[model samples]
Target: METAVKTTWKIDTAHSEIAFKVKHMMISTVTGYFEDYNAEVNTTKEDFSDAEFSFTAQTASINTKNADRDAHLKSDDFFNTKTYPEMKFTSTSFDGTTLVGDLTIRDVTKKISLEVDFNGVVVDPYGQTKAGFEISGELNRKDFNLTWSAVTEAGKIVVSDKVKLQLNLQFIKS
Candidate 1:
């Protein structure tokens, strides 16, 4: 009997991004990114049909191009970096198109499905084998204990509950 060695692919943070968008005041969109994050996947198949992925991002690393907004996100009103400094996700299944996983934020975990687009693999000019993927998903902020809310004096919402997540990932086989 022969044992197959699973190939481990680690995210190249320099070429990857973890970003999200949420409606602000029911009028405009606010975009944010986690400056520190990492992901890894192990697979035995060439097409990655059997790959299992796990990822995490530091809550304190949230950046929205605005210091005040970033600080607010790290406060108790949102991620609460002082208490839960990280968010995580682990894949349960992947079927080439849809990926079902458990996402944890602020100690609250929930199952979520994400659309995956495999951008194929290639050897970079630096002689490194790399794979790319564009993944998207959405979640309700309140579902993860990020339940802070506010209403304008005009009876409008200060923030929408829905948050759209986008991840552009690049991995190097390690």
Candidate 2:
């Protein structure tokens, strides 16, 4: 007889964050995050190769610390929040520490690969099991049609076409 084991993890929103950075004015960088997001993971074994992850982020939660700027980002020039209210990512493969997935934003879908490092898994004093992971990746914004920008006086685009994504995710076993 064979035994099967599966574990489920729910994202700890308060302890996790998703953020992105892109060049601005060819001299500085701008950073922001989606205020609301949800994700879950399931694994059939202790190793994460057989794991699955899926996440959804609310488009209206764009926050750059500036209300005016955030509102502009939600406009048609950028995410066009009225038409696409959410962004999502679904993992297709998890090979040890590498992850291959598809990310969909503003109605555009692109395949992205990330190098993930499993910080560790621990059992907390409260008897809860938790797993920590850090992932980093870069993607060309233009590839996803996030092409809103303006030429600066210095002859540079106000926003760079490359966007860098970084995620620190902590999940509690449920």
Candidate 3:
């Protein structure tokens, strides 16, 4: 497709999720989701190739379904929510199937690549045009300065550095 006029898209947060999982104690995986987040995309193609994407998730919004653990995660050892307060991503390139972006957390930024499965665009019952995407990736938490460490009494690691990301996103054309 030729470069057309760029269209703006807003995230449909009510139907989307920004989630990640990391091994806990080297035996179990703990899943967490950001309860508050937003994303914007501007693109000239309906397929979203070469789009300019920006995303942000509140660091304090991290939820793992556990209160104490959640609070701990917000402390200095991890996100230090009060200090950094937000996680952000800005896309550098998109090729329909892959996305390369600079992901920032705790004020640290790193270029990361993610696999994107464009689920195509559709009009909803409300006559709104929406696009769906499944994006997945992995990164070392330590890479972003989230270097809190711990150990189990039995000599097991508390939190694994490797985090797996799975984001299901829906965006509406505006």
Candidate 4:
């Protein structure tokens, strides 16, 4: 648990979750999660300032708990998984809390900042050094070229353009 030099940590996928919530039918919220993804963190300081992070999520593995809807999401109407199969993020700065990074979706890459809450580090009962983090951000789906939309009979948008991203991450020292 001591940081004498730079340390590397790998995300514990089994204990971490990456999810998004979007407004549905202009009335309700629908939540979805990525089943496949990985991330790595490297740091030179215990406070985590200047830490480096990289993440990748498999587009085809997205799930909204509905198969038909999930298929439609994988089509060109949404993420266009056939054309761009993965979304990636690479951190440019981490000031111990706020993290600025480049997020690439489809074929477009844009800089984004996410608020990070570090939940401290602990040595688990298994004797592994672990850290927990809660990260949240919002992004306009249209900016990533996910411009598909529809209006219902009552004139409500089927899907909202704003997507809220939430991540609960656990990392184990490596």
What does the lDDT read for residue 18 in candidate 2?
92
Query: Worst lDDT window (10 residues) for model 2?
Result: 44-53
Tens digit of per-residue lDDT, candidate 1, span 45-122: 878888898999999999999998888889999999989988999999998878899999998999999999999999
Candidate 2 root-mean-square deviation in Å:
1.1
Q: What's the CA RMSD for each of the models?
A: 1.0, 1.1, 1.5, 2.4
**What does the lDDT come to for candidate 4?**
0.94
User: Per-residue lDDT tens digits of candidate 3, residues 1-174?
Assistant: 864798999999998999999999999999999999999989998778878889999999999999999999999999999999999999999998999999999989999999999999999999999999999999999999999998888999999999999999999999
What is the alpha-carbon lDDT of model 3 when measured against the actual structure? 0.95
lDDT of residue 142 for candidate 1? 95
Model 2 agreement with the true structure over 15-90: per-residue lDDT tens digits: 8999999888888999999889999999987767788989999989999999999999999888889999999999
Instruction: List where candidate 1 sits over 4 angstroms from the true fold.
Output: none
TM-score of each: 0.97, 0.95, 0.97, 0.96
Better of 1 and 2 by TM-score: 1
lDDT ranking, high to low: 3, 4, 1, 2
Query: In model 3, which runs have C-alpha deviations exceeding 4 angstroms?
Result: 1-3
